[model samples]
Target: MSRVLVVDDEAGLRRALAINLSARGWDVTAAPDGATALEAAASTHPDVVLLDLGLPDLDGLDVIAGLRGWTDVPIIVLTARTSSADTVDALDAGADDYVTKPFAMDVLLARLRAAVRRGAAGEGGAPEVVEAGALRVDLARRTVTRHGEPVKLTPTEWHLLQVLVTRAGRLVTQTELLKEVWGPAYGRETNYLRVYVAQLRRKLEEAPAQPRHLITEPGMGYRFEL
Candidate 1:
């Protein structure tokens, strides 16, 4: 049985989710605000979190950060915010997936299952270090160094880099990168790829204008050449 923490302020929706998830054999815990959500997360230690961005007490992004400060548990944002900026902000804050409100219960369940699977698989068996030129990424420690100095990256940037570096010397299609980093809800968000890739180049490449490691594939995709 997988434990899931569902955070939302709506009484009806919260009760409905608890009932639905429990009926589906999930050990469900519900929180009506960000503070209780954080407390539930710490005490219950759920396998995945379904968080609403519009909490009564604290912004959902802060809750995401709070959980991230101590755990690597998968977080899936459920919100009414439909803008691309909101999507990017949630992902950058360490959310594993984002599902807009008024969503189908089945689709949400599928995403929940996927998040649980990814979390389980991420527990072990990844290369500890990946090196390219002056860049060194410690996958195990989730840290990066360039020219023997730390390279700061947002959660989304690191996720994008990890997806590419783990498959070094190959072109990662924009759709694939978006889905892998942002979640299955993303595919055609090519601008996301462009922005984060540029950020990675600025930090990892000797010259961001003339990059050696991160290469664009025009209409195809991008590649990380070791």
Candidate 2:
């Protein structure tokens, strides 16, 4: 059974998630606050995390950062905050996906399954190393280096880069990238692509204004050229 950590301040939602997930053969661990969620994550080593941003003890971003410090466990933010800035912050902080409040259980479950699959896939069977210009992506180690120096990429950023680099010299459509990197629930959220791609270019490209490897193919998608 796949383990899931459900972190929410609302007791009712926590219970509901635990019961529903448990019914579906998931080993569910519940936490009512960020501190407990972090502790549970460390102890249980869940395959995916469902986190709420409005924690009474700590911000959900902090929890994400804490988990990213030591683990690559997929984090899905569950929050009432629907602002783009909040979404970007959570993703940049290391969340694998984000779901706003008032979500359909089915959609959430699908996303959860997708995250688990992605996590498993990331564990093996990818190119060990990909080089583009001065950037070196070590897929085996999940690390990126540019100009012989470590380049720190958020989990989301790294995932995006991985998708592009693995398909190097190919055009990956916005819909495909969204579904592959985020979840099936995503497609029209091209703004998310714009934001994250810009962030990646800033870190990986020689000039953010004129990116070399990460190229945007106007109105279609992005291509990573060698």
Instruction: List clashing residue pairs in candidate 1.
Output: none
Q: List lDDT for all candidates, in order.
A: 0.86, 0.86
Q: Give the Å error, residue 192, model 2.
A: 14
Per-residue lDDT of 1-226 in model 1, one digit per residue for the tens? 9999999999999999999999999999999999999999999999999999999999988999999999999888898985656655676677866778899999999889977876776677556898888999998899999989999999999999998887565456666788899999998889888888888888899999999999986655677777
lDDT of 2 at 37: 89
Per-residue lDDT, model 1, residue 157, is 95
Clashing pairs in 2: none
Candidates in order, TM-scores: namely 0.61, 0.61
RMSD, one per candidate, in order? 11.1, 11.6
Q: Give the TM-score of candidate 2.
A: 0.61
Q: What is the lDDT of residue 84 in candidate 2?
A: 57
Off by over 4 Å in 2: 125-226
lDDT of 2 by residue, 1-226 (tens): 9999999999999999989989989999999988898899889999999999999999988999999999998888898975656665676577776777899989899889877876886778556898889999998899999999999999999999999887565456777789889999997899999999999999998999989999986655687876
